[model samples]
Target: MSDPIPSADPLDDLRALIRGAPGPDRGAVAAARARDAELTKPAGSLGRLEEIVEWLAAWQGRTPPAIHHPLVAVFAANHGVAERGVSAYPASVTKQMVANFAAGGAAINQICIAEDISLKVFELALDVPTPDITVADAFDRTGFVATVAFGMEAISGGIDLLCLGEMGIANTTVAAAVHYALYGGSAEDWVGRGTGVDDEGLARKRAAVEAAVARLDGERDGLEVLRHVGGREIAAMAGAILAARHQRIPVIVDGYVTTAAAAALHAIDPHAIDHCLFSHLSVEPGHRRVLERLGVKPLLDLGLRLGEGTGAALAAGIVKSAVRIHAGMATFSSAGVSERGVH
Candidate 1:
């Protein structure tokens, strides 16, 4: 064979890392499944919980998959789209919410405290709101790379599980625009009442998304789409997810904003998703469709529209419980219980 040609894209290294990331360990999965079959319970009695064990074992390359040092990172930023009167909350709310997060006044903070999960909020693109995507690129190429880099850095260290969340005014608008760009469709299908936008404000959000979609470059799925319609925090979360996979740290994904980032990365490279778990479904209209496109089901559907990683923190406990059940439950032989066929 001839020598392979070298790639020149700035994102090539990251892309290579993502694409090269390993999936769940098949040997571990086989062992876990065989063990499950021999357990006291009937075949597939635990449903997705059983499957979660398989997934965790496969990724950790051990039986009863492990969830260690759960970390939640909420990327906070401001979207220029918020300035267009699309969101019920003002752009200043993004900053105010960031303060609230730091002060432990936000929902995510209380959830993290109760769960004993480490939570950090990266104030990305706070002072510098992303440019209005309808009229110009939200961020230049370097800026996009830098934003992702900031997230990757924040998530560094040996984290067993990482939960991603976002806090940005009008980010849903940006996410809707990105969704439309990646998976072509009516903006109406992706648009929703972000932060309780009224009918008039929702209409304005749709109009903005439609215009942004109309102007997308010939390049439909790369940095162009991001700079055109992605929020800084969205980009940051995407980067963090990708890096978590690269580092063998699985991610627990939160609501719409975090899901939107995951979707964008999924569009880029689906393999990255092997390192992630869908935490919950949000009330946001676009969330279900995003999960559908991802071909995964969330662990919870709690009518959550609040972001800031609250969903991820709640789901973290469930993940640990799954592993605990897998590791702790007595086997058929150990418990002296009759096997399914015998009983």
Candidate 2:
């Protein structure tokens, strides 16, 4: 039979996915909690570690959560805004870094190796940078929808956990602009010294963010705001977050830029990122603000701002430890340890 014709509305499928997103598995959560109580440890002594295990169980839909095939996916793109000198690094660094990733020379490569996780770098047309948001919308509807589709396709290949990150010169500026559009604040509230820009560069970056948000004229839709200000990598990361929700894959989001990308989804549906874990608090100033806005606490605070999934990969090790502790520790009965308050 011939394949069914695609829907006329480009965003119809995405809308349905968001509306039909799944909730946590109560049975699995209960099972995890029960097992935790039986473990030879004081209740709540494990702290966030215990909470992490429960989150995994709820999202993975299993009694005890596991991370057998954790994958870190990094999307790299170039931005037209880089031409405005918002970042200290040249756009060529994005391409060079992609090559470095391929050569196993980047920090992410080493982290994945250390954590025994798989790393995949996706280059989103490094040659074709998205339009400078300060001057115009970054993407038309069709292009934005297509980039989101690419992100959805990224979730395939039987991965159990997903870590989302991005690489692009001036992407921090792009992310700041998106945040400015979504959450009403001054450009300084959203912009940061990406790649360690100088005072002049920081001022230019702030101006770019202000102009980008002003050009939008207070648009309300979350996805529309993203389309106006987001680049290919940010759009793809947002798409991957949504796709992971549908596929039941828990996500670990990297620092500032990734959080900004996720903010778009959060705006679309407050609970859209329920399955996600913020990996770290970036040194980037706006990261803290965005995290506060989302009301989600991150797993680490190491003053890390380097993108390329480095922070997420590091946090993945902690997650793996939580799973191991949950699954490997002996129960009170098995360990013959007397329960508290026993006669």
Candidate 3:
């Protein structure tokens, strides 16, 4: 056979990584299923919880999966699009919120504490906001790739489960633009009143999304679309997703902004995000469309639009419980319980 594709460019390397991701471990899945059959509860009574256990096993390549060290990583950045009045809050809010995360005062902190997951906040150059998407590309190729690499590094040490989220003013608008470019939808189909923007602000967001995509003139290469419209935090989240697949770590992706990041990778290859489980169904209208296109359902539907990884952390709690039940529950033999339908 001829030589495989070369990765002379960083974006080319990213494409290779996505395409080369390993598939689920069939042996691990079989082992998990065998154990599930021995549990005292009726077969499949645990519903998706049982499936979650198998999923964790298949991804972690182990018989019984456990969440010993789950992480909630939230990347924060400032978007130049915020200057267009697409969000109710100013760009300064991005930096302030990062501070809030650091001070342990944000909702994400409380959720992580309750769920026993560690939280890390990455602030991507608050002083250097991405270029306004309506007028220019969001990031040059080098900077974008570097940011992605930084995100990949976040999956270090002994993280078995990763929950990805973002904090960026006007990133929802950036996400809408990227979605429209990648998915060929109208601006309204992707735009939502993020951060409680009023009617006029919503109109501005739609127009900004429209203008940003129109500037692309139909450029739909996943990385190219991201380079043109995706923000730093979005790129980082995408990188985290990619890295999680390579490391065999299961990921719980947060709401719209984070989902849009995964959607970019999904556009590159339909199965690029197979390792990621969406955390929740955001009230944001675009999120449902993205999930439908990806052919996956969220773990919860608390009408959450907050973007600090709260939804993903909550989902992590459920995943933790699933693993606990699968590993901790007594087996039929051990408990001396009679099997169902035994004569």
C-alpha local distance difference test of each model: 0.83, 0.91, 0.92
**Candidate 3 lDDT, tens digit per residue, 1-343?**
9987666688998888888899999999999999999989889788999989988998899989888999999999998889999999999999899999999999999999999999999989999999999999998889989999999998898999999989999999999998889888699999999999999999999999999999999998899899999999999998999999999999999999999889999988888888888889999999999899889999999999999999999999999999999999998899998977432
Q: Candidate 1 — what's its lDDT?
A: 0.83
Which residue segments of model 1 deviate by more than 4 Å? Answer: 1-7, 340-343
Poorest lDDT segment (10 consecutive residues) of candidate 1: 217-226
lDDT of 1 at 282: 91
**Deviation from native of the Cα of residue 188 in model 1, angstroms:** 0.5
lDDT at position 230, candidate 2: 89
Q: Give per-residue CA lDDT, model 2, range 185-289, as digits (tens).
A: 799998889899999999999988988899889995678888999899998998999889888999999998898778988887899999999999999888999
Ranking by lDDT: 3, 2, 1
Clashing pairs in 2: none
In order of appearance, the predictions have TM-scores of: 0.93, 0.96, 0.97
Query: Which tens-of-lDDT digit does each residue in 1-343 have in candidate 1?
Result: 9965656655665566667777778998999898888777778878988887887777667775677688899888898878889999889988898898888899988998898889888887588898888788888777888887887778987778898999899999998998888887798989999799999999999999988888885456745577678988888888888777767677889988788788877777776787788989899888898889889899999999888888989999888888888888888889998786544
| Collision count for each candidate, in order | 1, 0, 0
